[model samples]
Target chain A: DAGVTQSPTHLIKTRGQQVTLRCSPISGHKSVSWYQQVLGQGPQFIFQYYEKEERGRGNFPDRFSARQFPNYSSELNVNALLLGDSALYLCASSSPVYGGETEAFFGQGTRLTVV
Target chain B: EDKVVQSPLSLVVHEGDTVTLNCSYEVTNFRSLLWYKQEKKAPTFLFMLTSSGIEKKSGRLSSILDKKELFSILNITATQTGDSAVYLCAVNNAGNMLTFGGGTRLMVKP
Candidate 1:
């Protein structure tokens, strides 16, 4: 079975531009989450979607948004990107069973570099 | 605010040595704590700890959660060079959001 997979392994965009990153969760997974990891830092949660609905969101700005599809795939969009937005965007998926003890598996991540 | 803090930021030890990493968290309605190992790309799940005192072991790596003390520790015994990586700790709260610590970068020298 394939793990979480992300599209556009890398991207370079200019400031104020908009970019969309895609993720395909593992088969049978119902939850997809997005996270941002800056250089030398751990990933920070952005948004989590379960059953195609937004379940949780983090402290990210309004420019950052995400949505999960009916198939449990997800896309993370960042508008008006700034230099500070350059980082690795990771997609994670989990089954969300057994009272939330399920472990999340992550994708290789899309490395976005905003110039 | 909900926060997770990891100790010693980084470590370097010789192969065959043992090392311990610590994680402490302060969050509302705590549910579970997780450990991940990141090599160069993405992070891979290592362990998910909920109940306290019960140890979860995988090969040479082990972890234990302390809900009463609001902390957890990961131990690696007889470490090998392949153990070099950044170990991350995250806490899952009632809100279903994961708050991650800064992570400890471990470099096991051969």
Candidate 2:
């Protein structure tokens, strides 16, 4: 089985532009979450979708939005991108296991550089 | 707001040495704590600790969580160059979201 997969290993965008990053979760996983990781920092959660429903959201501005398709793939859209938006966008997927298991496996992430 | 802080933002050690990373968190209705090793873009899962005192070990890496103190420690013994990476600490709260710390960068020199 393949691990979580992300598209466009690297991306470059101009300030004020918009961009969309995509992710395909591992097979049989229903929960997909997105995160932003700046240089030298840990990833910050942005949004999570479980079973095609918005499950959780971080403190990111409304400019950032995401959705999960019926196939369990996810897309993260960022509008009016700023230089600060340049970071590695990560997508993690996990299954809601019984007995309290919640280890989210991550993808290689898309490197976004907004100039 | 939920927060996670990691100590010793970066460390350098010779091969065969040992290292310990620390993580402390403050959150609402904490559920579990996790550790990950990030070599480049992706962070691979290391351990997910929910209960206190019980240590999770794999190879030379082991981690233990203390619920009462709201902190956790990760120990890497007999470190090898392969262990060089950013170690990330994260926590899951009732919100069903994982909040991460800034991470500790480990460099094992040969």
Candidate 3:
């Protein structure tokens, strides 16, 4: 089966601008999560949505937000962009949340370059 | 605060050699530990360990978890140039949020 898919493989935005990234989870999956990975660092959790509900949030600022749809697709929105915001945004999907039984699958990620 | 740390930030090894990567974590609630291999693009899943002391293996790669120690180790044997990538360790908390380590860069020179 096709894994998680993300849109806009690469993006460039000016300071203070906003960008929205999109993700389509694998078929039959019900959870979507967002992560940000800076160069030389591992991905940091941003947000998680399951069944169209916000199940978890990370230590990121309020400028970052996300939502899940009925079909289990998800979107990550970042505002007030800064050069520090330039990183690879990753989308991951998993089957319905269970106790340690769910395995997350990742997408190629969207490279966001904020200037 | 929740945190995950990996040792040997980077390592260089010969193609036919074997290498081991380590990861340790501290969080309020423990759930599972996951390993991913990142090449030029996305990070792909390698293994997920929920129970302690059991080993997971796939070809030249294998991993083991130590719940009592709150850590995990990934081993790659008979490495090849294609095995060069960043190995990341992440822990899922009770909230279902994942906290990731800084990652270890492994270079397998042919």
Tell me what fraction of the real C-alpha contacts between chains A and B each candidate also makes.
0.68, 0.84, 0.70
Q: What does DockQ give for each predicted structure?
A: 0.70, 0.76, 0.72
Evaluated on CA atoms against the true complex, candidate 1 attains a DockQ of: 0.70
After best superposition, candidate 2 residue A75: deviation in angstroms?
Answer: 0.6
Off by over 4 Å in 1: none
- Give the best candidate by lDDT: 2
- Model 1 lDDT on a 0 to 1 scale: 0.93
Q: For model 2, how does the per-residue alpha-carbon lDDT over B36-90 read when each residue is reduced to its tens digit?
A: 9999889999998999999999999999999999999999999999999999999
Which pairs of residues have clashing backbones in candidate 1?
none
Tens digit per residue, CA lDDT, model 1, B1-110: 88999988999999999999999999977888999999998999999988999999999999999999999999999999999999999998854468899999999999
Q: Pull out the clashing pairs in model 3.
A: none
> Among the candidates, what TM-score does chain A have in each?
0.97, 0.97, 0.95
Find the number of clashing residue pairs for candidate 1: 0
